[model samples]
Target: MAYLLSSERPAVAAASRNPLLAILRWAAKLRAERHQRLAFREMLEFDEARLEDLGLTRNDVLEAMGASAPQAGLHLQRRRALRSAIWLGRSSF
Candidate 1:
């Protein structure tokens, strides 16, 4: 009787049946964020010119580096995407 068109409907239903499954998913997500954060931290080694070439500034990297892993990744990604859309002329964004 419950017709669902969303792709995640099954996942949501399964998650309700097994609470620990949700915890494991959360842990996996955190681990992924940690890895992404480390990669972003490495960007700090780039000089201002190099960062600028990538459409990022030292302050942007510094700001992302200061946040939590997930937030930092989202912040950097969002900034880069915006830069690409505006500066790089990626109209598809």
Candidate 2:
């Protein structure tokens, strides 16, 4: 019997040594990505009028979905409030 011992190996090799850990990591990543994709899909369900009401355009939603930014929701909420204020002002005229 012959054995090759190496003191240094790639991190991937270490991960391969523990298949369970690698599988768990992969599953966690997949779940996170799935949730993100679902969020985008739900955004896509909104019609143009609904998006306008939310003070968001299709492009805004698309950009938000493409970029993983936690502030996107906050930005959209601000826009919605601004639009609501503008609409109220116009109604008062």
Candidate 3:
């Protein structure tokens, strides 16, 4: 493990205890989560033909949004990958 010099240690400790820094970090997290939700909303707006072009159904989007984590896009990607794997397995038969 890397050890911080005494001077650097004090600065790091002070930063961690800073209330403003904590709030800023919290606000940034909220903003990032909001952006993720907005992106999903935009995806939901796409018509069936457009969604089909993207290789995803409206149900896929809904399922992704239903995930407890804020990363709906990650869920969608996982779902798409699972579907692709299933299709590939069927084709190999």
Q: Largest TM-score belongs to which candidate?
A: 3
Task: Give a tens-digit lDDT track for model 3, residues 2-55.
Answer: 877765664565565778989999899888877877877899999999887676
Q: For residue 43, what is the lDDT in candidate 3?
A: 92
The candidates, ranked best first by TM-score, are 3, 1, 2
* Ten contiguous residues with the weakest lDDT in model 3: 84-93
Mind giving the per-residue lDDT tens digits that candidate 1 earns over 20-92?
A: 9878898999888778777777787888889978878878888987887658867877878888888767767
True-vs-predicted CA distance for residue 29, candidate 1, Å: 1.2
CA lDDT, candidate 1, residue 73: 63
Candidates in order have lDDT scores of 0.78, 0.72, 0.77
Local lDDT at 17 for model 3:
75
Please tell me which model should have the higher lDDT, number 1 or number 3.
1
TM values, all candidates: 0.55, 0.48, 0.65
How many residue pairs clash per model?
Answer: 0, 0, 0
The reply for model 1, stretches above 4 Å from the true place, is 1-15, 66-74, 81-93
TM-score of 3: 0.65
> What residue pairs clash in candidate 1, if any at all?
none
